[model samples]
Target: MTAFRLEQALGHTFRDRDLLQLALTHRSFTSPHNERLEFLGDAILNAVIAHCLFERFPRLPEGDLSRLRANLVRQDSLHQLALALSLGDFLRLGEGEQKSGGQQRPSILADALEALFGALWLDAGFDVAGRVIVRVYAGVLDRLTSGQGIKDAKTRLQEYLQGARLALPQYSLAGTEGEAHAQQFRVACVIESLHLRTEGRGGSRRAAEQMAAERALESLESAHDFSRQPRS
Candidate 1:
C-alpha cells in the first residue's frame, strides 16, 4: 500500500507529506527516521488509551484499568493494528533490512504505527490525532467494556499459580515452521510444581505462548474441580 492509500485509511491527510514519509522510514533506511516520532506517538497512544479506558470503565479499579491499557497498547496489539492498515507495505527499509524481513517484525511494525500517530499530531494537532486514534481503536475499545480485558490468559495463569505459592509458569519455543513472513511458532508452557505442560502454535512466539498459557490455565482449572469432587 502506498502512503496516499494509508492516509486515506487513516482518515487524515498529511499537511506535510515528509512527516508521514519519515514516520514510515526505518533507521536502517536513513538517518532521519521514525524514532523521534515513535517516542512522541507512544506517549500519545498511552494517554489516549488511558483516557478511553477511564471513561469506559468508571467503576473499575486503577489496577484493572492499567492492565487493560497495557494490553491495548502492547506491541502485539499495535502490530495487529499495523497489519490491519497494511502499514508494512509503506515502510522504507534499507536493502539489508528488506532482505532480512524487517518489515514483518513486530517491534518495527509497532514503532512505525506509533510514528504515524506522532506525525499526525505534528501535522495537525492533538484533537485531530486523538480522533484518528479513537477511530482506529473503536472496535477494540468497544469490546473491552466488560473489564474482561483486564486479564489475559498469561496473567490469569500467573496469578493462579502465584496465589498457591507455586513457581511461575515458564514458556519456551518448541519449534518453528513455514516461511519467514508467515512462520508458525510452537511454544511450550511448563509449570514445574504441578508437573503441567501445554503447547500451542501461532504466527508469533508471543501469540503461541499466550495460547499455551491459556491451555495450561484450563487444565489447572479442571484439576482444581476434580480435587474438590467427592470420593469417586
Candidate 2:
C-alpha cells in the first residue's frame, strides 16, 4: 500500500515523508527502525488521551480518568485504531515477520501506530498530531461518554451471559471502510446458542463490538424467548 493512501486515511499529510516511512519500518525490517519512534509515540499517545479525558470528565476523580485513559491507550485499543487505518498493509515488515503474519498481530500494529504518532509529532508538531489523535478517537470517546459508567456494554452483556450460564458472545471484525481519519469498523456479534447475530459500525473495533453487544442485549431483553435458561 502506498504511503499516500495511508496519509489520506490519517487526514494528515506528512511534511517529511521520511518520518512516515521510518514509522512504518519495523525493527525486523531494517536498521534505524521505528523502535525509537514507537517509544516517543507511546508517550505522546498517553499524554493526548490523558488530556482528552481530563477535559471530558472534569467532575470525575483522577483515578477514574486514569482508568479511562488506560482503557483507551491499551495495546488492543491501539491495534483497533491501526486496523481502522489498514496500517498493516503499509508496514515494512521483515520476510520472516511477513511470512509469520506479524502484520495482523496486536503488538506490532499497536507499536506501529505509536510510531506513526511520533512521526506525526516530529513532522507536524504536537498540536497537529494531537488534533489527528482526537479525530481518530472521537467515536471511542463518544461511546465512553454515552455509557457514563466504567463498565462498557460488552462487559455488562458478558456478565449477563455468564450469570445465565450461557456461552459468551463472539465478536469478529467483519469488515472495515476506507474512511478518513476515523475509519469505520464493522463487527459481528454472535451468540450461537440463541442463533443470534448483530452487526455494528464505529470508528474502532472496540466501539463497534460494544455497539454490537448493546444491540444484542437489547434484542435479548426485548424478546423474552431468548431468555431460555441453560440446564444446571
Candidate 3:
C-alpha cells in the first residue's frame, strides 16, 4: 500500500513526514535507526496497556495485569499485527537485508510495529496512538480476560517438563523434501533419556521446529493427562 493509504488507515497525517519515514527505516538502511522510537513505543505501549488493564479489570491484581500485558505485547503478537497492516512492504531496508528476507523476520516486524506507533505518537500524540493500540489489541484483551491467553502450548510443555526436572526439549531436522526453492523440512522433537518423540513438517527449519514442538507438547499433554492450557 502507498504511504498515503497507510496514513489514512492510521487516521493521522504526519506533519513531519520524516517521522513516518524513520519509522519505516530499518537499522540496515541508516546509521541511526528506529531503535529509539522502538524504545519510546515500548514504554508507551506498556503505559497504554496498563491503563486499559486498570480500567478493564479493576479487581485483577498487579501480577495478573502484568501477565496480561506481557501476553498482549509479545513479539509474535506484534508481528501478527504488523502483518495485518502489511507493514513489511513499507520497511526501508538495505539491499542485503531485503534479499535476506528481513521483511519476514519476526524481530524486525515487531520492532517496526512499535516504531510505527512511536511515529504516530510523535506526529499526533499519545491519545491518537493509544486509540490505535487499543483498537489493535482488542482481541488480545478479550483473550486475556477469558484466560485463553495464558501459557501457550509451547510454554505449557516447557513448564510441564521443568516441573518434572527434565531437560529442555531438543529439536532436529529429520529430512527435507521437494525442489530447492520449494523445499520442506521435517523436524523431530525428542526428550532426552526417553523414547518419547514426535515429528512435524513445514516450509522452513524454524517452522518445522515449531510444528514439531507443538506436536511434542500435544503428545506429552495427552500422555500426562494434563488439561490443555490457553494459548498466549
Candidate 4:
C-alpha cells in the first residue's frame, strides 16, 4: 500500500507528498515521525466530529453531542477506520517494532490515522479534511441508534439505579488471561438489588467493565418484571 493508494482510499490527493510520507512514518522508524501531526490531527478530528454531530442532531443537548463525538473519535473507532483504509500496510516502522506487530496495534494505527488527517489538513485545508472525515465515518454515523448518544453503558446503568434510589452497580475483576502485552481482562458487573450479575472480557479492565455494564443493562431491559421489584 503506497501513499498513492492511501490517497485514493482517503479520497484526497496530497499537494505535498512529504506530509503524507511523514504521517506514515512512526517514531520508532525515525526522528521525523507522525507525533506532531497526530497532535494536530487530534484537534482537527475533534472539531470536525463535533461540527458534524451538531449539524446532524440539532435537538440534542450538549452532553449527548459530546458523548457521540467521543464515541466517534475513540481509539477503537479510529482503528476500525484505519483498517478499512488498509493504512497499516503503508506504515513505516522500525525493524524491531515491525517484527513485534506494531502495525496491528490499535494505538499505533489510530495515531497514524490521525496523522494522516493532519497531513491532509495541511496539504489542503480544513474543508477538505472535514469532508474526508465525514466521508470515512458516514457509515458509522448512519448506524448510530438514538439511544447511543445519551450515555455509555456504565454511566447509563449507574444513572438508572441511582434514579430509583438503589445501590450503584458493583464492578469487580473476575480474572485475567493471556500474555503480559496481550492480556485479556475479565470483569463482573453486579446488581445485588436485582440479584443479577453479568461478565465481560476485553483487552483492558476498563473496556471489560464497560462490556459488562452493557450486558447488565441488556439483561435489565429484557427482564419482564424486574423493574417492578422493590428498590433496595
Best by lDDT: 1
lDDT of 4 by residue, 1-232 (tens): 6678878888898889899999999999998999999999999999998998888888888988888888889986786678668788999999877766666566888999999889989999999999999999886676566546534568768877887788998999999876577666889999999898999765678867876887787788688333453454
The lDDT values for all models are 0.83, 0.82, 0.76, 0.82
Query: Which ten-residue region of model 1 has the weakest summed lDDT?
Result: 223-232
List model 2 lDDT by residue over 1-232, tens digit each: 7899888878899989899999999999999999999999999989998888888877888777877888888876787678778888999999877766667666788999999999999999999999989988786686576225445668867877887788999999999865354356779999998899998766578767876886787798787544452334
Q: Write the per-residue lDDT of candidate 1 for residues 1-232, one digit (tens) a residue.
A: 5688898889999999899999999999999999999999999999999998888778999988888889999987787678668788999999877765566667788999999999999999999999999999875675465557745568767777776778899999999876686576889999998899999766688877876886786687677852232331
Q: Alpha-carbon error at 77 in model 2, in Å?
A: 0.9
Model 3, residue 81: what's the lDDT? 63
Per-model TM-score, in order, reads 0.68, 0.70, 0.65, 0.67
Model 3 C-alpha lDDT per residue in residues 1-232, reported as the tens digit of each score: 4688777656677898889888888998996788889998998998998899889888888888888878778886686567556778889998877766666666788998899889889988999999988887764465465333454545656776777777888888899876565566788889874567888655577756765666676676677654544333
Best by TM-score: 2
Candidate 1: global Cα-lDDT?
Answer: 0.83
Order the candidates by TM-score, highest first. Answer: 2, 1, 4, 3
Question: Candidate 2: lDDT of 15?
Answer: 86
User: Which pairs clash in the backbone of model 3?
Assistant: none
CA RMSD, predictions in order:
8.7, 9.3, 8.6, 8.0
Ranking by lDDT: 1, 4, 2, 3
Residue 31 lDDT in candidate 2 = 90
- What is the RMSD, in Å, between candidate 2 and the native fold over all Cα? 9.3
Which ranges in model 1 have alpha carbons more than 4 Å from their true place? 150-203, 206-232
